[model samples]
Target: MAFTNNFSTSFHWWDRIFGTDTKYREYRARVKAAKKAMSKEQQLEFERKLMAQVEAEGIVAEAEAEKMSLLGGNKKSKV
Candidate 1:
């Protein structure tokens, strides 16, 4: 025998009755408005800033991993 879950089905039914989540809709609207309002140069600058932030986060993560490896925190112990 197999068990099936209907949680998503009920949640979707409620969503249809009450409309989609408000916060998500508002976030999408804000992003759409921001994109629409940004000039070409502004958009390019925003993209550059976003890419820089992403690269910075990646570098930070890599440094953390390297530090952990150096401290032997990532080693697996055999029982």
Candidate 2:
């Protein structure tokens, strides 16, 4: 699934006009609980693995391009 914590807590909204905020709040709480349940070594391993998965999925490049575009940066070309 796509990332959830970006626009809002649960759903992105124009304002308080719409949202299913509780699910995100609950999700976040669960994440925090799980993290707390991990030992420090386990937490480090978990983060490393999660980041590796994202990179393997090619999200790192996509997110980098999106960030550059948002900042009015031009795409870089390799020569």
Question: Whose TM-score is greatest here?
Answer: 1
Q: Which 10-residue window in model 1 sums to the lowest lDDT?
A: 1-10
Candidate 1, residues 1-79, lDDT tens digits: the string is 0011112444856544566444334444655676788998987787677556656655665666666684455666576
Which residue ranges in model 1 land beyond 4 Å of their true spot? 1-33, 70-79
Q: What's the CA error at residue 16 for candidate 2, in Å?
A: 13
Q: Local distance difference test, per candidate?
A: 0.54, 0.56
lDDT of 1: 0.54
TM-score of each: 0.43, 0.35
In terms of TM-score, how similar is model 1 to the real structure?
Answer: 0.43
Clash count for each candidate, listed in order shown: 0, 0
- Model 2 bad stretches (over 4 Å): 1-33, 59-79
lDDT of 2 by residue, 6-67 (tens): 44444456323444444445545755776988998987787677656645544654566576
- How far residue 58's Cα lies from its native spot in candidate 1, in Å, is 0.6
Q: Which of the numbered candidates is closest to the native, going by highest lDDT?
A: 2
